[model samples]
Target: MVGQRQFDERRTLDRAREVFWLKGYGATSMQDLASASGVLRGSLYNAYRDKETLFLRVFDDYAEQFLADAAQALAQPVVDQALRAFFDFTITSMTTGVPTRGCLTTKTAIDTKADGERIRAALRDLLDKMERLVHERLSTGEARSRLAIPPAEAARVLITMTRGIVVMERVYQDPERLRATAAALIDALLTPVDPGRRSQTG
Candidate 1:
């Protein structure tokens, strides 16, 4: 029987997620994880195989939480309000959040090595999912009426703009600036386009 004193996998993964989110994969050593997780290095290795494995697990958890939050925001009755909530969340995450390590996926991608390709790919996939969610939310006639571009193209633009905002906030450390940028981006998204022009293309 498993002893009560035995460490919980879920708990350990949660702790590791915080640690990695606070520190990038390369910056976080096994010793740091051991200390943060309250588990010995040998035990961590035994449970997770290696640092990479542990990092991947943590990444998965982060991605899951991100997607869940975005989905909740998208559930709002007004699509524009939902999109604003999404941007607000992004700004809040950048200015606050426990890790302060910037976006994990972007950070990892910038410094990826041969072995880190899989991690990069996972991050890309998550972004793709987000883009799709945005596209679906914007595809409705009411939402499309407020958009300057097609639903698919507008989704892509919003994703890119939001990612850029996050990156800028990380470097600038200015909450007001970030908020202004977010507002501008949302305004651009909410600007009405000509239905006649859209019909011409159709």
Candidate 2:
């Protein structure tokens, strides 16, 4: 059986993550965490040492969940299918049901202070992992003919495009716009490479 103190600590961290996810690190206060976590301020301090430490725990949890979802999306049978699943997951998660806190990493990236730097670094690590997943899925020989450009370049472009879509969806709240943009991106991905078009025939 878990000790009372340990159970309370876990509960506090879970509630703290929700608060941080909703309000962001810069905006959230210790009072807010204490209230949201349903724990007294003294106990929160005892468990986490401080707000920064608590926020780091929340950030770690967020990164783990995001990467796990991405991994599942990338696990489809084919690269193009995997890419589509990945984008679809992002769109559906952002738009479906009640609007929850949007991407926590994107929310925290603009702060640029100490905690912000930590959050940004974590986000970069997540992006790097995502890019690697994309490269692996696309590097399969069967995926070659479907791609207009090299797998590495396409992965970079696709990831950038997907991130951009998330930003737009966060701001605009237009599902159709997001869907259209994603379709256009997929069309571009499906376009055939044209090396000959770059040459000066005249």
TM-score to true structure, per model: 0.86, 0.82
> Model 1: per-residue lDDT, tens digit, 99-194?
465666676766544146668778888899999999999988778878877899989998888788767877787767877786777787787546
Off by over 4 Å in 1: 1-5, 97-99, 113-115, 192-202
The per-prediction tally of clashing pairs is: 0, 0
Query: Candidate 2, residues 1-202: lDDT per residue as tens digits?
Result: 4324744666777888777777777888889998897888877777777787788887787678777898899889756577778888777766654665666666676655535555567778878887888888888875777788898998899888877876898789886798788777767876543457426432
Using lDDT as the measure, the top candidate is: 1
RMSD of 2: 6.3
Report residue 104 deviation for candidate 2 (angstroms): 0.7
Model 1 worst lDDT window (10 residues): 109-118
lDDT of 2 at 149: 87
